[model samples]
Target chain A: MTVFYVITKFLTFPGAITKALFEHIMCKVLKLPVEDTRCLRTDEMCGHIEHELVERPVAGFWLCFIPGLLNFLLGMSLSLFGVINVYCLGNYTGFIQNNALLSNLFASALTGNANLVSTVNFLLPILFLWLGFSMFVNMAPLPEDALMMKEQYKNLNGFLKVLFAPSYFVMRIGAPLERYGVTFILFAVIAVVLAIL
Target chain B: MDNENKNEELFDEASAIEEIEENDQPDVSVEPEQPEQEQPMEPETEQSVEDETVERLNAMGDEIDAEDLGGIPVTPPDDDSVDEETESELCVMCGEKPADKSFGEDYDLCADCRKRLVKAPISFASILFFILIIGVCFFGFLLSASQLSTLQAVSDAYDQAGSNHLYSAIKSLSSAGNIGWKTAKKAVSLYNDSGYLSGIASMVDAYFYDASASSDTKLTWADKVGKGNLNAPWNKDVKKIYSDYNTAMDAYEKYYAYFSEYDEQLYYGEIAVKDVPYDELIQKYETAKQTETESAGLAFISYCEWYLANMCEKGLETELQYMKAVQEACPDFTWLYLTKLTELQISAGEYEAAEANCKKMLQINADDYYGEYFRAMILRRQGKYDEAIAKMDAVIADYENNGFYYAYYEAGINAFLKNDIKQALSYIKVCYEGEYLNYNTANFYALLNKLDNNEEEYQAALDMISSNQAQLSPTVEKYLKKQITAEEMFNGVGNPFEQPAAESEAAE
Candidate 1:
């Protein structure tokens, strides 16, 4: 393979996208079915059994939607925290200069828990990166979900197609690349590595 | 015969269709719960009727086979549609009639645009890649941090080197230099642990080398530099600075040795003649065999001459005679020897010989100020006062005259002797206003004032001259008054340069 191939191959795994999708799959599987609760086991008990299956699992669309969104958001937030606290905030000099009040507060806190904070600060980037990439890979799309997206794509008019071209490119190319078993995971890995620097 | 062949073909086709139907049935083991539950009611369902249809098709196949064996010409089935070429498979994406190429089942691709979808390897590797990314980031961070730390160290060293504390400065500079030297030494020590760290860190080799050598040079030179004058010993900030600078040069030499790539550049790997102490060099040079230690001998002799020039304080005349003796013995061996001799000869009042040496001095250096000034002095002593004045003017004109009282004094004295009192006054005025920073210029001002007959100015001038010149011998005073000849004064007094005062304020 040439240099480009080596690079692209290394960057082949979709990280965040796949993680998000995988989480979605889990959420969907764990979710209870709500479509009119059909059951034939002992005709007299069928209604109660259907109610148990549907109501007990608490499978609302929010169950999938909330967690997936929360996971992605948390991953981003933590990575940003890692970057700011670990990378950009070097040796308290800037903080001391910029904010006397906060610096004093931080200094007092540091005096009490220097080792603890330092260790955490040191590991923040690693934890953030790991969890972030995990969520990305877990974000797998279900078959029905994919079919629904295809149906939506087919229904788009010409003007809407032009209007959504960029989004479509991202969905078709970027989303696929970052999907699990895709090179975008590797790219994300490389990017994370670079970002640390 | 054609009808019989057709019937036989129909029988074969019927059997293949039945086999396909049997294979298409759902697995009995898989989805057992769903299938078993459905099987109980299947007698009244579409499945039972489908089974009956299959039995009928089997019967028809059997009949066809019997007919085929009987050699009867059966009519071809009307259901046999007109024979037609098969329609080409169409591409799903572009709706074009595609070439016979397919990537996957149900995916007929066209020749114009065919791309196989390539999947990424390694799944759920977020944590591994994350660790790797962190490792890479930290590697870069560490490299930059190292560089930053080195720079800060060097900066700290510089700050310490500039400090007023000698011990601290010396210690810090030595440490900094050591760091530089070690860094430069390790610049090429790469055995596969290279990355951004080594790439950038290696670039500082030259910087480190330079810092190391400069530090070494300073330290070495500082070791030799003595501290403090007699009155205040070992406590001056200025002294500390000089001492630090002196020692820091050792760093320069070391760095040069360590990293300089050029072949022709000089490197002091070992201490040579210049680094040797003055006393040791003298002792070795005086006793060594000429042929065996020629280079050291030469160096020693040169250094001895320089030492003598700086230390000799007897008088300008003795200094002059010493130079002449060395010159006469060596016969212009070193250009410096001739120059010093000629200069001394002029100071000793040997005008003719000094003038003769001036010609030789000028031959060596045409624009030599020593030759020019002494030449002017010779003319003055020869009683060619106008020519002397003119030459003095020319000499002074060529050089800057900020505080050189002696040069202006010479011109003024000659002008005084020439009876051009106003011109002499002009020259003397400048020399005194220059604060006559040198003690000898007092005589010119006093004499000029006296000749002008301004008794008050003259008396003040005389008093000032008297206050400063306690070393003036009584006989030299008579000579100044023109009451005695130069020979008589020299014969009567011990040393003309000595103060004639039996008790002096300066001595007290």
Candidate 2:
């Protein structure tokens, strides 16, 4: 793992790794301006926080894809079925390390059957709610993203226009990206999770 | 009470069918040659109207020719008094007409005048409201009575089940279900939700159903066994307990979460104890220790680590370090933890640390009864078993409750290890009747009995563990009345004085 990943893993909440990465993709998707000391001011063309955007253009895709899939899986794996149980603990003691498998080895360790909350698991539920909540609270694109959307709209080729049609429509709504839709989706996700619980 | 008994009899009327038949058969079969049998078996006072009906019919047959035909049997002498009585009964409230019905057979009132005099101007709504009140009261009374009967039936069924009369308990359950269908159904549904009655009632159904199912299986297997079927052993497959276990687990989780809200000890204590990776478990422990929410959670890490070490079979040396580490980290660890850790340290030969732990334990809880015993364990670890026993005896002198008789157990174990059978027998007897009767404890008694030559006591202790084969190990066979030497009995197994090694977890 990278030093950044290790640092984030240790410092962050259980599912924050996925949440952080999703926002990174959202940053690129919206083309939202981020503050940069070098630029002296935030602007539409300012650099993003995701390291891959500054280092290598190709790596940016991986940053988006890896965390996206991970966040989705980690979020969805909160369900008992989506997750797996193993006999890591000694006989009689139940699941010790709950996690997604890695090369037939344990990757993420989950604390299953811990009585932290009767209705909720300590790690996964909090992470899911946080990730889904972030989607609503951060729905609105930055002011600079609105200007960038205009510039990108004029330059888009026919293929690109069709490819980004959904984002394009939302981008045209500008800074007032209308959170009711996102809020409703958030509640739906929560309802489903609670029902599963 | 009479009406309630009548209702219960009505529900059980099917069960009494044979008794009714027995009572009626003699009356029906009675003939001139058996006229004496026609007499009511029951006393005259207790003879039911139905029983008297047979005699009345016979008497009516004899008088049939003399009877006169009539539209009605009118008593004119009584009619004259009835009119006089009616005339005397004037409406007391309105005093306008003679009464239709008397009030208390004294003051009389016309119907309309009585209605007004009763409480207020009578209306249909008031009458209906009175009826509704009566209806609600009667319904509530029936509900409570039915629930009580169900509870009683369930209790009877459970008692019967314990005695292995499985079908009789089931029959009682059937009666309960029939008489209290609505009450029992409500109880089964809302049994665990609230209310003591529902909770107890629900348990009856759940337990009865479970008991019936289990007994049926046992009896089926036993019947086959009696028929010499070798394959008809009791099926103890535990996968059945976990069948649809996820549903119960979900409910349990909800209950745990709700309980943890009020007590973080439940929340953090269990979370810390969960089997996770060493680092993950440590992370939880560290978090709980540092948490400002509840001070009680801090000890969770110490307890968790101690248990994890034990589970992992970490050597005594490692255990010593873990115990010290917990003590060092949690200075204010609870009295129980300190007492437990001090004992572990003594076992690990960390007597100096154990002595310090004992002092820390006493400091934390000055009135702790375990402090002196912990100090004595330190002495025992130093090979001064005799001195340790003496110290333990002093504490036991003032101790009233028999929560743990460690002194008696330890003294016996030490004496037995040294082959001092006579002393072991005497010391072990004092530890009797307390402590969990696990294999080790049972074997302790078995060994004591064998040395003391008390064949019956030894056999009972030995049989206490016939269900588990491990307790019947070859070493345990020494307690059997066989011409075996002590060394031969413990040839493969270690000396019994030490805590015997547990069987493989799979075997369990």
For model 2, the superposed segments whose C-alpha errors exceed 4 Å read A1-197, B1-299, B363-367, B401-403, B417-419, B467-470, B473-508
lDDT of every model, 2 decimals? 0.43, 0.43
The residue pairs that clash in candidate 2, if any, are: A96-B275, A96-B276, A98-A110, A118-B253, A118-B257
User: Residue-wise lDDT of candidate 1 within A1-197, one digit each (tens)?
Assistant: 23432243233233333333334333345542222222112222121112112122213223323444544554454455334333332221122222334345566665555344434334534455554554444332323333344456556788866775554443444334332345334646665555433
lDDT of 2 by residue, B1-508 (tens): 2444333332233223334455765443323323433475756577554435445645554332212313323333334678776567877556778775533455456767644433332234433533543453343333234344545776676575555443345546556543222223222322222112224333333222232243534433212211111121211111122221223344334333422332454234343323335455545555655652332233344555555555445556656666666556545434325666776666656678778877765554333446677776566555566786777676666454644576666666556656777787776666545664555666777777877789898888767656565445445554455556443432222234233355311112
| Ten-residue region with minimum lDDT total, candidate 2 chain A | A85-94
User: What is the per-residue lDDT of model 2 for residues A63-116, given as tens digits with 9 covering 90 to 100?
Assistant: 333443443444333322211110000011111122112212322232332332
For residue A179, give model 1's deviation from the true position in Å: 39
Per-residue lDDT of A147 in model 2: 49
State the DockQ, from 0 to 1, for candidate 2: 0.01
DockQ of each: 0.02, 0.01
